[model samples]
Target: MSTKDVMIWRSNRAGTHYVADTVVMEEPLEIRIRFQDSDGKWVERPLSITMRTPGDDQALAVGFMFTEGMLLKNQLDKVTIGLENTVTVHFKPDVRPELEKLQRNFYATSSCGVCGKSSLDSLGYTYETLHLAENLSPLSPELIGSLPQKLTEYQSIFDETGGIHAAGLFDWEGNLILSAEDVGRHNAVDKIAGKALMQQSLPFNQHILMLSGRACFELLHKALALNIPVVVAVGAPSSLAIETAERFGQTLIGFARDGRFNVYSGIHRVDALVLPKK
Candidate 1:
């Protein structure tokens, strides 16, 4: 278990009191890509160092590569858990990744997007999957309200620690398919995406992706990578995230709580009948 029992203090009108509290453990996970370089020399490249909760490290690594456009799911031969807190992806035969693009000098923090990808040119393009049609059924307001509840129920770790982010995939009727929790919001999304991808369940355009926290650029990109059309977030959305979702024709819903949510883009995916009159 990546959780610790710690002492916490509370102050009231009388005095300070201490209680044992559960805290989600955060650690640095290094992702390495081992492949033959352009010169036919075998090299292991450290791609990213992300601060995340201790579990699902391999999923985070594979999903990172796939969403970053470094390696496709088909190109993934297998992932190997290595020594010293690292996970490495080994591609199939005759497949090589662009090693130069991954040589960055920034540490990816749990609270933010992918590190070292700071240029407009780098973030400019969407993967080809975004062009597909998201022919999903109209979502009900009641269903939308129920998603957060489902997420809360499945978050056993967060229930204990109260210090993690979660992402879940739900059908139009609001049935939870898969949910993953992590210290990083992006890592949580990546974990769910990796699970679906490994199960050959990509292009989830008919489904919805829900986030437990604010929707950011990386989370939006992860949804797009999987061809997920409707993104429901419990918090606000970044300006770039809204713009990217609008451009890709994705329904970006923010502040999704208490039976209400704000759809910033691709509102066509949502039914106006379920919305309030302006």
Candidate 2:
């Protein structure tokens, strides 16, 4: 755990005053990969260090590994937490990570996930995702509307920092499965994804992925990694995010709050009926 209190000088219309403000603890976490060498000895490799909000370091590492396509089910024999600033992922005895393919230096920014991409052509994803439209059940307008508030209710960190991003996993009836917050939205997503993976809850197609901010391509990519179908956002969706969701036949909803939302892709998953004008 990290400290939530930080001193700051507040300047409002009333006057300037010093106050003890709460903030999300941001720190650099080193994610190391431990695998067997050619001689069958365990060798530790530093994968990537990231700035995170200090909790759920293991989940962040696992989530990043899964979403980045750097891990396989069998490869993950076990996971262990190390020092306060480190998380180590151990693979099975015979499993080896293809280090060359995992080439993103994802450490520059806390909020931006695609900081070290090699090329735009790489955007053509290599992994195949489950087509969610065939299995999707329609979500009610009221349920979709309730997700943002539900997301907010679980944001203990954001309530203090007022500067962090959050991600929540909810069932069709708007029941919260889990939620996480970080300065980086992607990190928050990774933590939740990692937790689900650790618990073997893959293929979250029946759940809704609610975002605290605008929906982006990276978030969509992360959702696709787990085969999650419906994505609801409290803010807007980018054009590319919409296109990605369309390509996967996944439901993407944005501007979702206060009993209203816009469905950009896979409208069939949402019961958006046109009401009669009075």
Candidate 3:
């Protein structure tokens, strides 16, 4: 149910005609958590309700929890897809989540994620510090430039609806390892992270995260949560995104199209030709 078909009137210079059109489906998904209380009682509560595309609901829930620091890799016991548009995550009995620490407003839109937060401090989460060794191999600019085309090839939902954002995981050589699409950019990235978590592939330090839209602070934060050292976006990046990348020692690239890209932070990771002094 990723897309829906409808009839619309298409206009052109010559004339107008009625035609069938496909649109990306947007729906609300209720992510709930079931955990054991200190008294050895089980509690189920609604965590968040986000608007996203219909598919990959489980991954979305897992990734969101991971990024928000509510669930760790080992804490996950199982995920059950409840009634329509609802997902319940059961954590291990020993894993008691600090629900009060979550400062989110409990509702999120498809476009922006952090907008639902209560304070700026809530934007920060505890993650492993990223350390790039001097001997680490640098990625070529050519490979970064080719990521958009590689990602586009696998974007079935985007091809059909033409209105979905995507996040793709790539190897050093620019080979797409996995990708996810949703109406919201953050949801897509969450799906990728969630799938990786399920597969026991935490800490994507050796991978590159590619985005189909402008880079934002939340996206960078999610990448940091997964320890992804490199992030490349097809569009421009916000000022906060640059500052975060600089502070975290992550490689950030934007405007990654037409076989060229601009490296904003961690230039050491890009093998760009040194310019001659004037």
Residues 198-255, model 2: lDDT tens digits: 8888768788899999998889888987778899999999897898888777889999
Off by over 4 Å in 2: 103-108, 116-128, 131-133, 274-278
TM-score of each: 0.90, 0.91, 0.94
Candidate 2, run of 10 with poorest lDDT? 118-127
Each model's lDDT comes to 0.81, 0.83, 0.87
Best TM-score goes to which candidate? 3
Ranking by TM-score: 3, 2, 1
Model 2's C-alpha root-mean-square deviation from the true structure amounts to 2.6
In terms of lDDT, which candidate is strongest? Answer: 3
Clashing pairs in 1: none
Candidate 1 residue 155 Cα shift, in angstroms, is: 0.7
What is the per-residue lDDT of model 1 for residues 1-278, given as tens digits with 9 covering 90 to 100? 67999998978899999988899999898898877766777777778888889887788888877877777878877788998679988877667776666676358888876645564356656556365465566777778777887899999888998889999999777889888999999889888877776777776778889999998888887787777888999999989889878787788999998888888987777776654789
